[model samples]
Target: MDFWILAIRIIFLVQNTTGIPGNFSLLFYYLIVYQKECILKPTDLILMHQMAANTLIILSAGVPQTMAVWGLKQFLNHLECELILSIQRFGRSMSICTTCLLSIFQAMTISSRKFCWKDHIVKAVKYIGCYISLIWVLYILINFIFCVYALIKMDNKNVTRDFGYCSIIENDKIIEILYAALVMCPEFFFSVLIAWSSGFMIVILYRHKQRVQHTMSTHGSSRNSPEFRATQNILALMSTFLAFYTLSSISRGCIALLYNHSWWLMIVNQFISLSFPSFGPFVLMNHYSNISGHILVWIRNKIHFILF
Candidate 1:
C-alpha cells in the first residue's frame, strides 16, 4: 500500500467513525433530552432532519467507500448496490434541501417584525413538517433513476463505468443527459437558494450589529442578542455546507470528465463528499449551547460516579 493511500484510508475511517456517533448524539439530544424540557421548535425539527440525513450519508456512502478502499471489492450484490446508492443519493439530496430550508427559515426568523411576509413565515413554520414531507416525496421521485441504473460491478470487459464496489449500467446518450439534468438541476436550484438566503442573513446581521453598536454607546453596555448569535451560527453552517459541497462537486466532476475509473480520484472524491457530513454536526451543536452544556455535565457526573 502506498503512503498516501494509507493516510487517506485512515482519514476516511476516522471521519466515518466520528461522524456517525456525532450525528446520533445530536439526534438523541434533540429527540430524547431536549424535548423532555421544551417543545421542539421548527428549527429544531429541521436540524434533527439534517442530522438524520447526514447520518444516512455517512452510513450509505462513507462507510461503503471506506470498505472499498480497504480492499473490499464486489462485496455488494446488484440489489444491495442499487439500494445503497439510492439511499446515498436520497441522503445527499435531503442534506441539500434541508440546509436550503434551514437557511430560508433562519432568514425569515430574523427578518424585521414589519416585514411583508411576517404572517407567511409564521404559517410556514406551523406547517414545516408538511414541507419536509413534500421534499422527501419529490426527491424520491427525482432519484428513482438511481434505483434503475445502479448495478453490481462486473468484469472489466463488461463494465462501462465503475464506482469501486458498484457500477452504473450504461445507457443511451439521451438517458445519460436526462439523468444528469435531473440530479444536477435540483442540487443547483438549492445551492442558489442557499446563497441567496445567506446573503440576506448577512445583510440582516449587519444592520442589527450597527443598531446594537449605536444603542450600546448610549447605554454603556454591549451584548449579542440571541437572534444575532443564532443567525451567525446559521451563516457559518451555510458557508461550511457551500464550501464542502462546491469542493466535492468539483472533485466529482474532475473524476467524471478527466479520469474515468481512476481509483485514487474516486477515493479523493469520497473523502471530499464526506467532509460536510462529518463536520457539520459540530457546527450545528454550537448553536445549541444548552445541549453541549448538559452533555458535559452528564459526562462529568458519570466520571464522578465511576471514580467514587
Candidate 2:
C-alpha cells in the first residue's frame, strides 16, 4: 500500500478506536454502574440512548469506510452494499432526531414555570422509550430508498468513476430529488427544532440569572444549583453538536455539488461527516459531571500505580 493511503487508514482507525470505546464506556457507566448505585435521571436516559445511536453510526459508516480504504471495497457484494448504505442513512437520520429530542427535552425541563406545556412536558419523560422507538421507525421508513437504488460496483474498465463499495444507481432525476428531499426534510426540520429549543433555553436561563442576581444570597452557589449546572451543560452540548453537525452538512453539500472530483475533497468530506459521531461522546462526557470525574479519578489511580 502507498504511504498516503496507509496514513488515511491509520487516521480512520484512530478515530474509531477513540470514539467507539469512549461511547461504550459512557453507556456502561450510565446503564450498569450508575444504575446499580442510584436511580437514573431522565437526562441520563436520553444520553444513554443517544450514545447507543452514536455507536451504531460509527460502526455502520466509519468501520466500513475504513475497511474500504484498506482495499475491501471490491469485495462487497450487492446485498452488503445495500445494507451498508441503508444502515448509514438510518444512522444519520436517527442521530439527528435523537439529538434534537435531547435538546427539546432539556428546553422543556428548563422552561419557565408559567409555560403552558411545563407540566405535560415533565410527565412525558416517562415515555422516552416510546418516543425513541417511533423515531427509529420513521427513519427506517424514510431510508428504504437506499436499498432500492444501492448497487455494488463492478471492475469494468469502461466504467469511468466508481463511488467505491456502493453506488446509488438512480437515473430518474425527479425520483432522486424526491428521495433526497425525504432524507433532508427530517434533518432540516430537526435542526430548526434544536435551534429554537436551545435559543429558548438560553433566554430562560438568562432571565433567571438576572432574577437571582437581584436577590443574591450567600447560600446559593452557581456550582451547587442543579438547574444552573444543567443549563450550562445543555448549552455546551448544543453548541458542540451544532458546530460539528453544520461542518458535516457543508462538507457533504460541497462533495455533492462538485461531483467528488478531488481525492482531498473526499477525505475532507469523510472527516467532517465522522466528526460528530467520533467526537460527540467526549463532549458529552466533559459536560457530564459523574462520568468525567470518574474517568479522571481512574486515570489518576492508573498513573499513581504506574509510577510506584
Candidate 3:
C-alpha cells in the first residue's frame, strides 16, 4: 500500500474505533447510567441525542470510506450509497441544530433575570424533546435531495474525481452550485445560530466574572463555581464545533474548485469534517461535572476491586 493510503487507513481505523465506542458509551451513560443517579436535564438530553447522531454519522460515512480506501471497489450499491449519504448528512445537520439549541439554552440559563426572554426561554426546555423530533424530521426532508443525484457506478479507472464511494454527475455549473447551496444552507444557518448564542453567553459570563472579581480576587472560587464551569464547557463546545466546521468547509470547497482533485486533500478534508462529531462527546463529558464525577468513582471502584 502507498504511504498516503496507509496513513488514511490508520486514521480511519483510529477514528472509528475511538469515536464509535466513545459516542455509544456517552449515549448509554446519559440514557441509562446517569438516569439511575438523577433526572435527565434538558442539556443532558440534547447531548445524548448528539451522541447518537454522531455515532450514526461516523458509521455511515467513515466506515464505507475506510473500506473503499483499502481497495474495496463499489463498497455500496446505488440504493445503499444514497441512503448512507443522506443519513450522514441528516445526522450532521441535526448535530449542528442541537449544538445551537444547547448554546442558546445555556445562555438563557445563565443570563440575568432582567433579560427579555428569560421566562420564555425557561419554558422552552420543557419542550426540548419535541424540538429535537421536529429537527430530525426537518433535516431528513432537507437531505432527501441527495437521493436524486447519488448513484453507484463501477469505479472507473479514467475518472479522477473522488466525491465519495458514490458519484454525482453534474455537468452544469449552475445546477451544481444550486445543489451545493441547498445542502449547505441549513448548516450555515445553524452555525450562525451557535455563534450568536455563544457570543451572548460570553457577554453574560464576562459581566458575571467582573462582579465576582470585584467582590473577591481569589481565582479558585470563581473558576470552580458551577456556573463558571458550565460557561467554560459551552465555550469549548462552540470553539471546537466552529473550528472543525470551518476547516472542513474550506477543504471541501477547495476540493470542488480544484480541477485535479488530490486524493490526499479529500482524505484530509474527511478527517477534519469528522473531527467535531467524533470528539464532541468526549469534550462535553469531560466538562460535565456530574458525569465526570460518576466516571471517576466507577474507575476508582474498579481499580480497588482489582487490587483487593
Candidate 4:
C-alpha cells in the first residue's frame, strides 16, 4: 500500500521476469544448441554452470523476497525456509566460485601460448568437468550443514527470528561470528582470485594492443581472435560481479551488524543481490553475437507470423 513497497514490488517483478527467462535461454543454448555448430569449450561449460546457479538464485531467493515484500506473511514454514535458504546459499556460493574459475580460465587461455606450461593448462581444461563436479559437491555439503542447523535451531522457541515470509534461528555471538567467517572468508578469497585474474587479463590486452598498433596488417586478425574476445568478456563479467557483489555484501553486513531492518535498506539489499542474475545473461549475450542474432531472428519470425 505504501509507495516504497509498491516500487520494490515492481522492481522485483521486473527482475524476476527478465532474469529467469534470460538465464534459461542462455542455459538452453549452451547445453543443447551449442555443440551442434562448434566444439564446446571449457569456458562454455563454466558459463553454463554459472547460468544454472544464477537461475537457482533467482528462483529460490528472488521470488521469495519478492513475495515477502508484497505483504506475504509466514508463507513458508520452517522446513521450507531451511530448504529454500539453503538452495539460495548454494546457488550464491557456486555463482561466486564459477565466476572466479572463469576469470582464471580465461587468463590461462590467453597466456598459455606464451608460457611453457601450455600442456598443463590443456590438461586442466580436459578435467574441467571434474573440477565443476567437485565444486558442486563441496557446496552441497556445506549448505546441507546450514540446513540442518537451521532445522534444529527452529525447534527452539526462544531463538527464532522472523522475516515476513520466512524465519531463521538467532544464534549466540560465537556461532554468529563463526557463520559469518565461514561465508565471508571463502568469498573474500575468491574475490582476490578474480581481481588477480582480471589484472592479468588487462595486462595481456594492453600488451596486445601495443603490438597491434605497431603492426597494422595483423591488427584485425589479432583483435578478432577468440582468446582476445573471451578475455575481454570475462573482464567485463568480473567487473559486473564485483560491483554488485560488493554492494550486496556491504548492505547485508550492515543489516546483520546494526540490526537495522529498515524497509529501504532491505529493499536495496534485495535489489543489489538480484542485480547480477538479472543482467548478467545480457552481458554474455552481447559477447556472443550468434546468441543475439538467434534471439533477433526468433523475434522477427514471430512478428512476421502474427502479421500474416
Candidate maximizing TM-score: 4
| Model 1, C-alpha of 265: deviation from truth (Å) | 1.7
Which regions of candidate 3 fall more than 4 Å away from where they truly are? 37-39, 148-168, 171-182, 218-224, 289-308
Between candidates 1 and 4, the one scoring higher on TM-score is: 4
RMSD of 2: 5.1
Clash-forming residue pairs, model 4: none
TM-score of 2: 0.82
Clashing pairs for model 3 are none
lDDT per residue for candidate 3 within 1-308, as digits (tens), equals 48877888888878888889878878767765665767678887888888888887899888877777777767566567668867887888887888888888887777746478767776787788899999888777766755554342223223434456765333345445655676577678888988888888788778777888876765445444676677788789888998998898899889878888777798888888788878887787777647656666777877999999
- Report backbone clashes per prediction: 0, 0, 0, 0
lDDT of 3 at 137: 82
Q: Where does candidate 2 stray beyond 4 Å?
A: 1-7, 33-39, 149-171, 212-224, 292-308
Number of the candidate with higher lDDT, 1 or 4? 4
My TM-score estimates for the predictions, one after another, are 0.88, 0.82, 0.83, 0.89
Identify the runs in model 4 with alpha carbons over 4 angstroms from their true place. Answer: 34-39, 173-178, 217-223, 294-308
TM-score (C-alpha, index-matched) for candidate 4: 0.89
Candidate lDDT (C-alpha), each:
0.83, 0.74, 0.76, 0.84
Per-residue lDDT tens digits of candidate 2, residues 174-203?
Answer: 545766788787688899898899898888
lDDT of 3 at 197: 84
Residue pairs in steric clash, candidate 1? Answer: none
